[model samples]
Target: MNNTYLTTEELAGRIKYDARTIRQCLKDSVLLEGKHYIRPFGGRKILYIWEIIEEDMLSSAQSNLTIPMANGAVWHG
Candidate 1:
């Protein structure tokens, strides 16, 4: 599959989030490594997979009552 890779700044612009927030807050919390982003060539440069991020963002929005529970489970009301 062809994936759209984006830098933090580019993703911030597309998602309307501050680049600093993306790097500091969302980088390893909401946006996980390997799934939402990657360090190319084992270096420090991070590239975000836009397709996966977008998909999760939309899906999370749709499930209003779905809460993240302990032990990696989700609670749906």
Candidate 2:
């Protein structure tokens, strides 16, 4: 698979985000389980897959996509 495994702190360092933020905010909302991370042996410890994360980050950045606004709001980009 050639996956680079990383801890929460390590991923935070690579992505320049707070580890707390990654854990509290971006875990399921952004970084999905089994895709960006895995709980080996169905345990508590989570290992982040760095290659997948890095690839997704770069690909998403390259795509100029925007979040759909609500409440009759609009995006002009």
Candidate lDDT (C-alpha), each = 0.94, 0.92
What would the TM-score be for candidate 2 when compared with the true structure? 0.81
Enumerate residue pairs that collide in model 1: none
Highest-TM-score candidate: 1
Error of 2 at 75 (Å): 14
The C-alpha RMSD of each candidate to the native structure, in angstroms, is 6.6, 5.1
Per-model TM-score, in order, reads 0.82, 0.81
Candidate 1 positional error at 4, Å: 0.4
lDDT of 1: 0.94
How many backbone clashes can be found in candidate 1? Answer: 0
Candidate 2 lDDT score at position 3 = 85
